[model samples]
Target: MLSQPETSEALSGGSTGRALVIHPVSKTPPGRVSNQVASRSTGARLDEAVGLARAIRLDVIRAEVASVSRPRPSSFLGSGTVENFAELISEYEIGLAIIDAALSPVQQRNLERRWQAKVIDRTGLILEIFGERARTHEGRLQVELAALTYQRSRLVRSWTHLERQRGGFGFLGGPGESQLEIDRRLIGERIARLKRDLDATRRTRALHRKARRRVPYPVVALVGYTNAGKSTLFNQLTRSSVTAGDMLFATLDPTMRRLGLPSGRQVILSDTVGFISDLPTHLVAAFRATLEEVTEADIIVHVRDAHHPDSEAQRSDVLNVLADLGLDQPTEDGLIEAMNKIDLLDPTTRLGIAQQRLRNSQNVALSAVTGEGCDGLIEMIDRRLESASRVVRLDVPLTDGKTLAWIYQRGEVLGRRDDNEAAHISARLPEEDIARLRHRQRLH
Candidate 1:
């Protein structure tokens, strides 16, 4: 059971998805920052809340920022604040009010009573988006598991609806438990089953990743805040048509494609689900299986929308999530920062960006949309992946064209010597190829 103050609010209310987006500007704790995203003005936060609502096709009737301090235990806002929203809801005929703050369960119910509308906090809203966006089987299971965990403790509000709306003979349901107990029992059972399914899914995904490791291609994962041009950069690099959209969470599932570097070396580039500020803890735990791709990656490409107002704050959120996943620091050799979307920047900003990129060897200043500076990004990836591996000398029979061709195809040959009977070669290659050459030499 959640403490009355700390319980995550998920109200069950009357609605047809029409919403009023509200961003609460509350008092900051001592020594804590008031803003999550730097300079994210209350109006901007409210706008983002409206965007979240629109992401799911919700009809946003109104949006505003509500200023509050030292939250009232009963409603999280002052009486005046609640009364103001009540008037807004009545005038706008709003069916839903999305509070852009974590609300206790009690606060949610009180808000609903005062406004005569359904109320949901940020966590609940994100869950709804994930539910609507999840397409793959694993994604659905992950969303369901998170939703169940979120719904578990909020069982207090929706029980009345469950009791009132059913057409069933109360007969052999004999001595049926109260609606609350029934919901608890059903949800408990479902949650248990979802957990089991997700566990199996996690193991299967692990096996798949292990199989990829054996295939000799290093995994380069693209990570950033949602709508950070990851998919755009991925498509530009790999020339594969992946869905890139202008909305948050447009890419919910992790996508992987074969990427060919300028040196003719192939790699597996992965586009992962983006991170966000105030991400629900339930989601973090639930999506761990999918996010293991980030942990297991050989390289992490931090894609940033250089034009975004909250770019730095978004970067902080991504780093925090990475740190939480046990990656305290990105690999120095394999890390790259693609300051993408430069096409959207002004000339002065572009000059500054160029100077910044010059300071950081790993930084790639590229506009993924216009195909600018992409070759440099590829070269950066190649250099980083190569720095760890060393070149080796090898000898193959002159008549063994197949073996020689394979070596040329898989390695960067620095030099080759031709003799009547054999060919000597010096090539930059991984140990896997070196071993393969030695095995073939023995067989010959």
Candidate 2:
């Protein structure tokens, strides 16, 4: 079990801190309910929000639902709701207000002033989790980039004191001190440096990818909503003890391991950071390098918690993130859906849905924890890989022994026969390598 910080002070670098959760729900119109209405179970959302807050060690004194407000403004609650929140803040002596929704900097600042507390929106909370969970240098860089991007908009809040003027001598009393200005300038420089460093990291990652390609193994990436059992599935598939938990954003660094499919084909499977709704744009931008794994994947396994009430919504959110990563094109045919955690569902329902999906030529459903249906999933992956491969039958001249040797070394030779004039070879090769071989055959 992941340990929670004993107090907010231990987590946030201070003792005088408390958080109030504000989730503004808009009332539906008289006749029709807009699809955009907040329809998620308030209890579930609150549970998740509280879990996230606790993970960050925030001292959440009180968590409540502010009044449902209209025209949402994508930020602070309505003026009236803000007023109520102000009163609650005073009553609770809250030091921070954590809005469950994404908040614009303008609205964030306004809310902070009204509540007389620091305001951390959903995006900031996620970034804080990433900052804590990132372990690798590349992962750290990605998190830092995302955090900086998120902070850029809120710089005004962080440096508000910069606007104040210090008491100075008539001409130049030792130059008025401006802590906020200094901090802002320092942060700006750090952002620039991080960008440069990330650029280098991206290049390093590119080189690593090139090396992997030379080994010629297919790459399978696991992607899904936060707490959708990605790490569990990854651990199940790879037998590697990566951190797995029920909390949101439990795994931050992308983990890769070699997996042998049922057909005896080996491929690299990577577990990436989980996606979430209303993810901050800066966080996405900063984590672009980490997500690039998805973009470059030979196959994408979209894992989801099959028993979750919001499974469909969670699927939508995962796809939205994939779209943002430029993997939304119709040409992305290698995508597979893994309805994970089937053990949590009724046996009949799980089997029925799995059978239905299989019959429809869709992907697989399995419980990553119990290992149920795992073999079928592996077989499905193998079939997909086989379908995408190119089959080649080469008749090489007996004198061209080097070519025959090369073919044997580079391809998965299915059959071979020696003839007086040539050696007939049947093999399965990657589409690109097959094309190159055909071009070379014609040239020779």
Residue-by-residue lDDT tens digits, candidate 1, 1-444: 221221122222324366788887876788987754555556656777887778777799778887787788999989998998888777777777888888887898788767766677888778777876777889888887787777777765332212322221110011222433336788889889988998998899888876765455778999998889998888898898887888777778788999988767678999888888889987998999999889888789999999987777778889999988889898777688899999999999999989998888878899999999898988998888877656788778899888877776666678889989888888766667677767766222
Give the number of colliding residue pairs in candidate 2. Answer: 1
Question: What lDDT does candidate 1 reach at residue 98?
Answer: 84
Error of 2 at 174 (Å): 31
Per-prediction CA RMSD (Å): 7.6, 8.0
- The prediction achieving the highest lDDT against the true structure is 1
lDDT by residue (tens digit), candidate 2, 1-444 = 001212222223222346777665556678976565254566667777887877656678888776554645544576777787787777777767778887787776566555655677777777667766778888877776676566655555332212324310111101222323224667688789999998887888888887776566788889898888999988888899999897788888888999998777899999999988778777788888778978988888888888887777778888888898887752435877888888889978787776879576656888889998777777877888898886778888899878876666566778879879988888777777788788877222
- Candidate 2 residue pairs in clash (backbone atoms < 3 Å): 9-14
Angstrom error of the Cα, residue 43, model 1: value is 3.7
Instruction: Please state the error at residue 286 of candidate 2 in Å.
Output: 1.1
lDDT of 2: 0.72
lDDT of 2 at 51: 75
Model 1: how far is 276 from its true place, Å? Answer: 0.6
Give the true-structure RMSD of model 2: 8.0
